[model samples]
Every structure is written in structure tokens, then in C-alpha cells.
Target: MKQWKLGLVVVLGISGLFSGRAIAAEEIILRYGILERTVAVSDLSQLAETGEATSQLQSYFDTAEVPAEEVQNMLNSDVTVDGVNINRILDNPLGDVLLDEVSKSIYPESGSAGRQAMRAALVLSAVDDDRITVIEVLENYPTSRVVLDTERLAETYEDFQEVGGVVVTVEDTLDDVLNVIRILETLSN
Candidate 1:
């Protein structure tokens, strides 16, 4: 009787474990450049809590040929191409053409640095417009730059009041800049 009772209990326990509710999963569509992907996430909260979402997102960006790190660096740094400082050209009437030329000169290689340089060049070209300079665009749209650089512009200015004002002004236009970067990356491949 004791042996039979132990066997029954073990069987019941095994069945109960297997009968537990299944985890619910949802499908999310992510668009990167020209590529679109649909991923099923079983537990979003769990993934976020574990900090695995970032790695998953990074893998997606890698598939799209846009190294997230490189893009981040390019957006943060002061970039110059073909002997012309991008900031100086931003205000010039011929900035668009100059930026295009610079983009063309970027080395066509698959390495992370090369790909990043190419993306940066393309982003600069995209921002080149006759109506407004990059600074003016940022100034007009205050929240846009925050999307690109969550930490905000890291560069410090000697005149905090004047330079800080300029940074704030440009913040609004950062979205347009990012849009241009996305468009260029999409069309490149």
C-alpha cells in the first residue's frame, strides 16, 4: 500500500507540472533600413528585467548592416570629410553638394569602421539642405537631438550661456537628421 501511494503521488506531481499554463507571446514588427522583421517575444517584462532587450535589438541592427555603436559614435562626434569640416559646411549654401561629394569618397568596405564612416558620410549628405543649416534645424526642433543622443550633446562650451542656448535650439532638429540617416542607410544597399 505504501509503495502504491508513493507511485500515485509521483505520477500526479509530474502531470501537474506539465499542465501549468503556457507563456503567452506577442509578435512585434521592427523596421531597420530596408529590412523588416517580425519577432515573437514570450515575455517582454522578463526580457526587459533581464536587460536582454538591448542584445536582441543589437542583433536586429546588425542584420540591417547598421552597426548601432558606429551610428552612436558618428552622431556624438564632430565629423569632417574630405578636408571640409561638416559644421562649417552646414551653414554654407553649397553644403548639400559638398556633403554628397564627401559621401562618395567614403571607403566602400565591410568592416565596422568603414561601414560607420560610410553611414556618417551619408548622414551628413542627407542633412545638407539649402533652406537651413544643421545647427538651425536643431535649434528649430528642441527634442529631436535627444532621440539620437539620449545623454544629449557631450561637448562643453567655454561660454555656457550662449553655447548652451545653441545646443538647446538644435535639439529640436535631431529627428530630421536621424530620419535622413535612416533613409540613406536604407538606400545604400
Candidate 2:
């Protein structure tokens, strides 16, 4: 039988992302080395909805050296994933690894809380429309201030690309383990 339940969850906890409501983030603090800038979450929402970049949001693209078009693609690119499966994947050790990588870029102001915050952002974002996007993640960021490191986004992007692989891998592992347990129980019986 297929393990359809393995598709979901992390620090802050996989449970936290799927359950409690997080305070919506107000602004995103874009950081690159010693330089830092802030863009209101509303600004991002407008851009995602209309494809128009406000001056403040455009400034961040210029400072981060990330192409505006590419960032926009990221902002709106939607990945369809079931909520329960996403929660399961994010709650595991491998999920923590993915969280750690992403949190490096998009996290709370405190920085240390990046892992859990990232988990919540992704889960809540996915919860919104049965899909998740970069903009959705930012909108659901579980803090007043969300930080994005423009320099570190490449790895985060790569990790996101692997979400499909992670889901498949987790399900396979669960099936294998469950099969072994069944065989061992049969032998004992």
C-alpha cells in the first residue's frame, strides 16, 4: 500500500506550522553583508498581485543584486502541495535540514529563530491556497520582521526544487520501514 500520509513538517516544530496561528509579518528586512533594507509586506503583496514593483521593493532588488524578473518569478511561482504531506516532510530531520538552509535566507530578525519561523512561514503559506510561493511564505512569516538574505537565496531556491524529491523519498522510506516491521512481526508470530 502507498503511504500517502508521509507528505507532511520542524523547529518552532512541524506541529506549530500546521496548527497555531502565527502573527503575520509586517515587513521584510532584506540584508546583504553589512547593508540592510526593509520592505513592507504589503509592498510585496501588491507586486505579486499586479506585477508592479514599488520603489522600495525595487530598491531591494537593486541592492541584493538579484534580478527583478527572477525575484518576481519566485514571488509568484506556486507549488501545489497537500497540507498534511507538507507538514510531515517539514517535521522530520531532513525537513529540519531544508528549514536550516532556507532560514539562512528568510528568517526572523533574531536570526536564531530562522528554522522554526521558516517552517511556520512555509506551512502557513501552503495552508492559504493549497499552494505555496515565495510571496506567500513572506506574507505568513511568523514574526513582526522577516529577514531575507539576498546572497543566500540560491541555496534556498535549490532546496525548494528538491521538495518533490523529498516527498518521494520520505514516502519510500516510510513504506520500507513499515514493511520490515510487518515481516518481523510475521516471523515472531
Candidate 3:
């Protein structure tokens, strides 16, 4: 009976991990000018969690114009987010503009699905912790492949702050709304 219960739990856990989503982003293609390098998402995640960059990622680190510490700060910083509010915000006009700006920097290979994928990534990342970090967004990205345009990444990071601020404001304003956000989040999905 014990063994059977353990097997069932493992199966359920695995199912929950994937749910109905596509394969999460595995690698990011970083592009700068004519140069491009494919980096594993796992390596980036590790570097964000721990401050050490691996040998495989070292060369890219060396070539980066931004200091390592700043890079770490950007990756490690996070915002409290709600999936339902994120969904609602991204469907509006201002959100569309923000998405356009952000999408120019980090997007899937297709390019067109940038906003949708970004929304999904942000929502999925916040599902468990209500905290969304750059690393988590990259990890939960809805595509198996993603692109990071170095020229625009820093600028996009700034634009992303605006969206984060909006989320914070919404959280403050919507606090006493009687759990409507939670219900909307489910219905939106």
C-alpha cells in the first residue's frame, strides 16, 4: 500500500509540472550585432541563484559590457505579481505598448507571439510563489527556444519596471475587492 501511494503521488506531481503547457524554454539565443551564442536556460538560472558563472558561460560573461554584479542584481531582483492582474493588464492598450517594447528584446523565434508568450511566462512563474523574477520568466517561457537581443535587453529591463509598478499599484488598490481577482484569474484561464 505504501509503495502504491508513493507511485501515485509521483505520477500526480509529474502531471502537475507540465499541466497543459508547451515545453518550457531550454536555451536562449543571445544576439549582438553579427554575433550570436546559444546559452542553456539552466546555466543562467544557476548563475542567478548562485553568484558563480560556469565555464561554459564564462566567455559570454567576459564579453558582456555590464558588470557581473549588475547582471546578478537584474537577474535576482523580483516583483510580487498576480496572474489574474497580469492577464487583465496585458490585454489593455497600455499593456500592449509595454509588451511591444519588452518583446523587442526577449522573444520567441517566431517574433509575433512575443507578448502572449511573455504573459504566459510571467503568469506561470507567479503561480507558486507570487514572486516573478527574470530567471523565472526565462525558465517558464512557453517556447522551447527563446531569443535575447543584447542591444535592447537593458532598455527592455527598464520598460519592464513600469509594468511592475503598475502591478504594485493594482495590488494596493484591489486588496479589498473580495477575492474577485482570484476568481477572475481562474475564469480567465
Model 1 TM-score, 2 decimals: 0.22
Cα lDDT of model 3 by residue, 22-136, tens digit: 4478998978767788989988888898877777677776776556566667777787776445656667787788777877888998787798777667766666666778888
The C-alpha local distance difference test score for the whole of candidate 1 amounts to 0.35
Clashing pairs in 1: 138-169, 138-170, 139-169, 139-170, 141-172, 142-171, 142-172
CA lDDT scores, all candidates in order: 0.35, 0.74, 0.74
lDDT of 2 at 74: 74
Over the stretch 19-113, how does candidate 1's per-residue lDDT look in tens digits? 45121113333444355555443222333334344566567756766565543443323322221223443334444444333323222222123
Candidate 3 lDDT score at position 159: 72
Across 77-166, the per-residue lDDT of candidate 2 in tens digits comes to 776765555676788888888888888888878767788778777877765456778888888787878887867876677777777566
Scanning candidate 1 in windows of ten residues, the lowest lDDT window is 142-151
Q: Where does candidate 2 stray beyond 4 Å?
A: 1-22, 63-65, 172-189
The estimated TM-scores of all candidates read 0.22, 0.73, 0.75
Can you give the lDDT of residue 80 in candidate 2? 70
